[model samples]
Target: MACLVIHGGAGTIPRASLTPEGHQAARDGLRDALRAGWAVLGQGGLALDAVQAAVVALENHPSFNAGHGAVLNAAGEHELDAAIMDGRDRRAGAVASARYIRNPVLAARRVMEASDCVLVSATGADEFAREQGLDMVEQSYFTTPLRQQHWQRAHEEKAGLLKRERTEAEKHGTVGAVALDDLGNLAAATSTGGYTYKRVGRVGDAPVIGAGTYAANDVVAVSCTGLGELFIRRGTAQDIAARILYRGDDLSSAAAAAIADLTADGAGAGLIAVDAAGAMAMPHNTEGMYRGSVTADGVLSVGIYSDDFAAVETIG
Candidate 1:
C-alpha cells in the first residue's frame, strides 16, 4: 500500500521565534500523522479510515488549527466545520457551523453512514452526534485563553479599518488530510475553526465536500485550505480533479494549475493531492503553507514555503 498526506499549513507558526527544535517538532508531528495513515493502508485498512486516522491525529495536536487551537468566533466561542468523502461510493457527509463536537470529521462520516443527506448544520449535526453517542463537550470547553486573547487583539487591530485585509498573518483557520489507498480507494477530509472573529454561523469551505475536499478513484483526492471565498467561487478541489479526469492532466500539473488559477484570481490558498499512482503535490500561493507527504517508497518530505525561493525551504 502507498499513502500520501498533506496539511494546508501549520497554524500559529512563529516564524521569527521558531527554533530549529520547534521546526523539527512540527515536521515530526506531520510525518507521524502521515505514518499513522500509511500504516493503516499498509494493513489493508479502508481509505476512509486512513484519512480519518491522520486527521484525528492532527486534530488532537494543540499546535495545529483544526481542533484544539481553533480560532474563536465573534461570540468568543469555537465553532467547527468538517467533511469526509469516500470516492468508491461517492458517499459524502459534512457539518457546518458546529460547536462542541470534538472530531467533526467523524461526525461527517457518521452522517454519511447513517443518513441519506449530504449536509448537516450545527444543531442538526449535534443531534446526530448525540444519537451516535459521540463525546459532546460544553461550548466553554471549546475556548482557550490564548485563542480568546488573539481574537481580542484581531478585533482591536481591525476596529474601524474597513479596507484592511481581514486576515492576520498568524490566523489561518483550516486543516485537512487526503489519501489514496492500496485498494484503489480514495478519500479526503477537512476540518476548521473558521476565521478568527468570524460571525457566529460563518461557514467556510471546510464542510463542503466538493469545495473544501473531494476524492474519486478515477482521479485523485484533494483537500484545500485558505481563503474560503475564492475556493467557493472557483470550486478549487473538484476543479482539480475535473482537470485530471476530464482534461487528462496529471496530478502535479493539475494541482499546480488549479492553485495558480486561484492565485491569479486573487485567492490566497493552498492544496494537497494524491493520485491513484501515489503521486503527490502540495502547493500554495501564500508566503508559506505547512504541508508534507510520504511517498510509496517510505520517503517522507515536508516543506513550509514555495519552492521558488531557496531561503524559505525549511524541510524536505
Candidate 2:
C-alpha cells in the first residue's frame, strides 16, 4: 500500500478570522501538494522522493509558510529552514536560517545525497546550495504584502502601540509531508519560515531531525507543525514512533498520546504520521490545522477546521 500525508501548519485558527478567498486558496494549495506527491507514488517512486516532492509543492505555494510566502523575521528578512530523512538508514539532512535558497527542502535533499554532514546553517547553507547549483532567489522574492502586514502588526504589538491576539498565520506555520512508498520504505520532510516577528537567526523544529521530522521502516513516518520551541523540548515527532515501538501503542493511539501531552501544555500542535501497515493518523491540539491526505485507495481529502475532514474526491 502507498499513502501520503501532508500539513500546512497548526494554530489557533478561528473560523471568523479567515476570509472566503483565503479558505479556498488553502484548500487549493493542499490539493495541489497532495497530487504532486501522489503522482510520484502512483508511479512507484521512492518514499523519500514522494515526501520531497510534496514538500516542494507546498514550498512553492504562497498560501503556506515554507518558501514563497515565508514569514519575515523582526529584522524584516526571510530566513528559511528545512529537513529531509530516509527511514531505511535513518539518514537525514537539514539546513537552517538559509537566506537565498529558493527551496530549502531541495537543498536538504542535496545535502543528504551529496554531503558528509547531517546539518548546515546560515551563510554556509546558502553558499553550499549555490555551489550545488540549486535555484537561488533574491531575498525580496519571499516577501509578500500579507506577511509584511503580519510583521507590522507584531512589531506594533511589541512596541506596546497595539494589544491583540495573533491569528493562526501569525502565530506560526510550517509545511511537511510523510509517505509510504510501494516498496514499503517511509520518509518525512519538513520546512518553515518560523514565526512572525521572530529573531533574525532563530532556528525552529522544522530543521531538526528528531524534533519535527522522523521516519523508520516498519515503524512510522512523522512530520510536525506547532510552536517550534515546544515541539523541540518534547521531541514530539520521535515521541510518536517511540510510543508505538516501545510502549506497544497503535499508530492512532500513539499519535493521540503525543498530542495530548502538547495539549496539556497549551502548545497548539499537529502532525501527520503513516505506519508501515498503511495506517494514518493526523492528530492536532489546535482549533484547526491545514492538512490533507491520500490513502492507499487513492481517496484524497483536505481539511482545515477541526470538523472538516471528509474525502473530497479520489485521485488517480
Candidate 3:
C-alpha cells in the first residue's frame, strides 16, 4: 500500500480574502503534488523518491512560497531552507540559508545521497549545492513584485509606518510532503522561504531535523509548518512520531496532540503525517492550512480550510 500527503503552510486564510479562482489554484497545486507522488509510487519507487518528487513540484510552482516564489528576507534577499527524511533507515538531509540553488529540496536529497552531514547552512550550503552540480538560478529569479511589496510593507509595519496590518496569509508559507511506498517505507519533506522580512541567514524548523521533518518505518512520517521557532522548541515532528511509537497513540490522536502542544504554548503551527499503516493526519492551530492526502485505499482529499475538509472526498 502507498499513500501521499502534502501541506502548503498554515495561517489565517479568511474566505473573504480568497477569490474562487485563487482557491482553486491552490487546490490544483495540491492535486498536482499528489499526482506527482502517486506517479512515482505507481512505478514502484521508494517512499523517499516519491516525496522528493512531490515537494519538488511544489517548489517549482510560482503560486507557493518556496523556490521561485520565495519571499524576501529583511535584507531583501532570498534565503531558502529545506529538509527530507527516509523512514526506512532514518536518513535525513537539510539545507538552510541557501541562495542560488533553484530547488532546495533537491539539494537536500543530494545531501543525503552524498554527504556525511545531516544539515548545512548559509553560504556554505550554497557552495555545497554548486559543487554537487545542482541547478542554479540568478538571485533575481526568486524575486517577485509581490515579495518585494511584502518586504517593504513588513519594514514599514515594524516601524509603525502602516496603519493596516498584513493578513495572516502573508505572514507565513511553506511546502511539505509525506509518503508511504509499496515497499512499506515512509518519508517526509519540507521547504520554505521563512517569514516575510526575516533576518538573513535565519534558520527555521523546515531545515531542522526532528523538528519540521521526521520519518520512521515503525511509527510515522511528519512534516510541519507555521512558526518555526515554536516548532523547533517543541520538536514538533518527532514528538508526534514519538507519541505514536512510545505513548501508544494512534496517528490522528498523536498529530492533534502535537499541534495542541504548540497551541498551548501560544504558538501557531500545523503538520502533516502518515503512519506505517498508511493512516494520514493533518492538523493545525490556525484557521487554514493548504493540505491534501491520497490514502492507500484511494481516498484523495484536499482543502485550504478546516471547513472545506468535510466537503472533499476520494477521487474515485
Candidate 4:
C-alpha cells in the first residue's frame, strides 16, 4: 500500500489567466514529479529518498516556483528555502536564504545526514552545500524571463506606475511531497523561492519543520504550501499530526480541519499528506492547487482545478 502525494502550490489561480498550453504544462510537470518519486518507492527505496526525488523533479521543472523558475525578492535576488524530514526517527534538515545551491533540497538532505545541525542559513548554508559537494549555480540560474517581468511589475505597482494590483497567483508558490514507503516509514519535503518581491532574507514556512513539513512513522507525513506566515502561526503541518494523534481524527479529517482553520482566517493555501497505512490526502482552500498521487500498483492521478482530477492507467 505504499503511496506518494505532491503539490506544486496553492492559491487563487484565475482560470482566465491560464492558457490551455500553460494548463497542460503544469499537469505534465506534476506527472513527471509523481513518476520520479514512484520510481523510487516502487523499487523499495526509502520514503525520504522518494520525497526528495519528487521535489527535485519539481524544482527542475520551469513551471513551478522552486529552483529554476524562482521569483525574485525585493532586492531582485533569489533566496531559496527547503526542508526534509524522516519519520523513522524524526531527523530533519533545512536550509534558508541559500543563494548558490542548485538543489536546496539536496543540501537539506546533506544537513540531515552529514551535519549535526538541523538548520543552516544564508552564506553559511551555501558554503555548507559547497563543502558537501552539492551542485551549485549562479544566482542568475534561478531567474526566468517571466519571473523578471513579475518582479518588474511588483516594483511598478509599488511605485504607482501601474494601477492594477497583482493577482493572488503571483503572491506565493512552493513544491512539496509526502510519501508512505513499503517499509511503513513516512517522509516529507518542501522547497520554495519565497513569495514574489519579498524582503531580502525573508524566510518562509517552507523550511520550517513543524509549520510546512512534518513526518512521523505510524502517524502522518505532511508538506504544505501557501501563505508562509499563516502556516507558521498555525504550525499547520504538525497540527494535522496532532489532530490525528490526540483527537483520533483520520488523515483526511485532520488535514481538512487544519485547512478549514486556515480558510476561516482567509488564508489561501493547501497541503499534501500521507499516513503509515498509505492513505493520502490533499486539501486546499484556494480555487486550485497543482496536485497528484501514485499508488504502489502504479496508478496515477493529477489535478489542478477543484473538479479537474483524473486518474490515469497504471504507470510503467
- Backbone clashes for every candidate come to 1, 0, 0, 0
Distance from true location, Cα of 72 in model 1, Å: 0.4
Candidate 2 per-residue lDDT over residues 237-315, each given as its tens digit: 8998899889989999999988898888888889999999999998987788999999988999999989998799998
lDDT of 3 by residue, 12-45 (tens): 3578877887788888888888888877887788
TM-score of each: 0.90, 0.98, 0.95, 0.97
Off by over 4 Å in 4: none
**Model 3 alpha-carbon miss at residue 286, Å:** 1.1
Candidate 3 stretches greater than 4 Å from native: 310-316
lDDT of 3 at 244: 88
Candidate 1 on 63-122: residue-level lDDT in tens? 566777678888778888899999898789998887878888888999999988888997
Superposed model 2: Cα runs more than 4 Å off: none
Question: Over the full model, what C-alpha lDDT does candidate 1 score relative to the true structure?
Answer: 0.76
Worst 10 residues of 3 by lDDT: 307-316
Question: How far out, in Å, is residue 307 in model 3?
Answer: 1.2
Query: What is the C-alpha lDDT profile of model 4 across 205-251, one tens digit per residue?
Result: 99999999999999999999888999999999999999998889999
Clashing pairs in 3: none
TM accuracy, model 3? 0.95
Sort the candidates on lDDT, descending order: 4, 2, 3, 1
Among all windows of 10 consecutive residues in model 4, the one with the lowest summed lDDT is: 163-172
Model 2, C-alpha of 180: deviation from truth (Å): 0.5
